[model samples]
Target: MNFPTKLKKLREEKKLKQQDVADKLGIARTTYASYEQGKREPDHATLVKIADFFGVSLDFLLRDENEDFQDKIFEDEAKRILKDPKTFLAARDGEITPEILDAALEIITEQLKEGRKKKSD
Candidate 1:
């Protein structure tokens, strides 16, 4: 499943109307509907809010079920680390120290920001 599908499923599972979610998110119902329709992409901050609202990780919301799971997991994990660098920890194979992982996540976060900036430009 893709983002729109996942978002809609999550909302339905929670038994929420679009307006309820929109009110919580401080957005219009039409904007939330567009998101479920795959017509609009929320920014990074909004993505975080949505994930928090649904009690899900960013990776879960953004993951493409048909794609390679591990690859998406790592990417989403990077986003999660950005949100809480002090608490997040993960290792691919070799052991990684917390300080080193924090630094790496910072770099990834910067890259993600730059990528989004480029897209908007």
Candidate 2:
């Protein structure tokens, strides 16, 4: 896909509107819309900012035929999470509360139980 298409997809995946991205990038909504429509391209600095905001690499944003970019991006994110488990956990709800941790553990335990029951059946 082209840069504009990729940008639009990424922004949508993050549940952000054009205005949200524009505000984050400190640009106008019209400018961001132009980017999504391929009417205008952001400069190198803005490209870097966009990529950083999306937690993706510059190549992922620019390359048309780079099909493995998604895998690479996920792998990088996984490594980052593994490197700092607490930070990753905290990012889920914007803060690492004991209630959140307990809830996560409860969900995991329930899933394990369900899996075991399925296996037995």
Candidate 3:
């Protein structure tokens, strides 16, 4: 949710050790650990370097996931569901349950994130 959490998550997702990332970024492992531990923050340049290393925008590191970008994902998903005749009719007839909808959205979001990560890789 926050920068430190995101940083640790990104590293874990890449299957890299903290030391590996620190070495790649030319920083001491302890310094990188401090960043991930939320005991310290990186300066702007280092933040940019981290973003570049992860192939993500600074905005992704700095902003909350539940912001506009998340809203856009939901909006786009809703539009897609509306455009599909089967889903549209199901929704109109109240055939789709809320649990089903939530599960669908969660799967879609995960798939989208994976696709984006693959693209970056």
Candidate 4:
């Protein structure tokens, strides 16, 4: 299914109205409805919000029909990784080996600063 269809399906499966999702994405209900109706498209930032809200990956959200299964796989694996006992212990202890911690931090920083056009000092 395409983005509009998939988006509507996801929202319906979650038992949410367009306004409910719009509130979560911090956009207007009309805008969200347009997205579902395929009359308008969301930008990368909004797309990120939608994917995050639905717990799917960008690749899965934008990819063709063949890759649908990866959505659940990635979503489940991410949740598992976050809630794993080792991850919990690492958070509690404030360490998970210096290298691993640094890598994780870098990934988070990159994601949070995705639209950067220039480097900061």
Q: Provide the clashing-pair count of each candidate structure.
A: 0, 0, 0, 0
Expressed as tens digits, the lDDT of each residue in 26-113 for candidate 1 is 8999999999999999989889888866645787888777865434444554554567654453222233345445655777779899
Q: List the residue pairs that clash in candidate 3.
A: none
For candidate 3, give the lDDT of residue 68: 47
Give the root-mean-square deviation of each candidate in angstroms: 11.7, 8.7, 14.9, 11.8
Residue-level lDDT tens digits of model 2 in 1-121:
7899889988886678899899989999999999999999999999998986775668878988746545545544454444566656454334344443554555567879999999999
lDDT of 3 by residue, 1-121 (tens): 7889889977885679999999988999999999999999999999988975664567778876655443333343344454474755443353443543664577679889999999999
- lDDT winner among the candidates? 2
TM-score of each: 0.55, 0.63, 0.55, 0.58
- Candidate number with greatest TM-score: 2
Clashes of 4: 0
Q: Which wins on TM-score, candidate 2 or candidate 4?
A: 2
For model 2, the local distance difference test gives 0.73
State the lDDT of candidate 4 residue by residue for 1-121, as single tens digits: 7888888887886679999899999999999999999999999999998876775567767865854553443343344335474643543244233444454455557766874635452
Error of 1 at 111 (Å): 34
Q: How far is candidate 3 from the true structure (C-alpha RMSD, Å)?
A: 14.9
lDDT of 1 at 106: 72
